[model samples]
Target: MEREESNNNNKQHFSHKHILTRLQLDEVEEITCNACECDVEEEQFYGCTDCKYFLHEECAEAPRSIEHRSHPSHPLTLHAAATYSNQSFICDACGYVGYGFCYSCAHCSFDLHLFCSTLPHTIPKEEEHPHEIQLVCEQEKLLTSDMISICSFCDAMNTECWIYYCETCNFGFHLNCMISKVVEEEEEEEEE
Candidate 1:
């Protein structure tokens, strides 16, 4: 292999010593991120274009370690990709089977998606609701196993996901439905 270097700040200092260039992928069908093992769609990602080694920009810059609030028992370590035989892990925060860019607690075998692990504690009332809403990812503490959670924002019921809530007034939103703070009408506007 030939040694190469670059002066780009965003793609600098990676665990692997490879020359990665920032790219805006076009209408790609099935390009996958080597780090996270997820599909690399038409978005800004970092990779060696010639080698076909790709990484989501978020995955490329994910912190090596984090002190996440949801799992205070131990600090989670960022893994470039799952090392399991099945090549995936169930996300503890959202209860979804995820591939790529997982934060794992080796001691407990608990894992989380990079996006789910970083949800903010509270959304201000000014964003989209009357009262401040808090994200609730540790669902076992608040919800009964038999009951399903419903997103007040979209009226979608889900058994495996986190919710954002305003404790004062009981407003709720699923992380998936409101992660971008996008409402249904906004989606409709884009289709017009």
Candidate 2:
């Protein structure tokens, strides 16, 4: 009986009781991650059929606190809801306004999107570039002129999107551009 009890305990400890379960496409009706607020139609996701809680597998597994290079002064804590009265948050990393799960610093009022928080520190240099591109967090200060900061990769004016910048070369890239570039590279590698 003691051996059986021990086995049960082990199973309980190893089981994904708290983890979300993957659902079939047919099973995914209109569920979305409470964390990132992204719909299941975009990607495969995990969810609770009973409680109706859902999360992107990545969002569900995000670290409770992270020591991001962008906010080196203190570690940012993951928050399911904003503690402030504004009911919204603007990402310091990407410059986009959102109302969802965020990595936040209460002391500094710094916020980052889940996807922005998980961005890689460095990316391989594009064929046109001579050095590896480094990610830098730049705060968008109010400009008096109508001019806009342009993305080094796409040559488009940076508006609400997050930017990855290299201090050494003064190069910048929009978050979407970087993500797409990485995806394209991965697809090319898979083909090769």
Candidate 3:
């Protein structure tokens, strides 16, 4: 009886291990890298686990999506990178390369970063300016060329993307730049 119980315990443990490995694999999907254009198996970043869907970790964690949050009274959606006609924009999130993923108020020209749009009214920064950044309008201050100016957000200069103004200061950022910060944080934590 003792031997049987030990054997059964081992079997159950093995089963559990197998299930865990499968779960990890399930979180991964086949995707082509935008940079290398090579096929690679990438893990899903942020998405619905129940659906038969997954995005590349980069795609999933994209600071902006087609969905809109309730803070704004308008709906925002994602657009292909090529669709943008304006210039001098940046993602206020990861500082990546895009004017694609953005949150916009359909009723107005109010645009925000996928990440910045979701930030609370105040943020605690360890560096740079002391005061927390808040959202403000830059439409009037924006030069016709400003529309094409390189946004401090998303870090990429010359790309057309959603723009946001800091209420605390006249600072501007792109959506992707903000998302870059999140990615950097995650990477640093992993290194530790």
Give all candidates' CA lDDT scores.
Answer: 0.71, 0.66, 0.40
Lowest lDDT 10-mer window, candidate 3?
A: 1-10
For candidate 3, lDDT tens digit of each residue in 92-124? 333343343455544554454444545554445
TM-score of each: 0.70, 0.63, 0.34
In what order do the candidates fall by TM-score, top score first?
A: 1, 2, 3
Q: Which stretches of candidate 3 lie over 4 Å from their true place?
A: 1-117, 121-128, 144-172
**Candidate 2, poorest ten consecutive residues by summed lDDT:** 1-10
Query: Candidate 1's residue-wise lDDT over 1-192, tens digit each?
Result: 332333353465354567777766666345788765557764567777577677777778778999887778899998866657897998877666777678999898889887777778888888556888777776573466433356775687764677777777656767777744554666689799
Best-matching candidate per TM-score: 1
Which candidate leads in lDDT? 1
**Candidate number with the higher TM-score (1 or 2):** 1
Candidate 2 global lDDT: 0.66
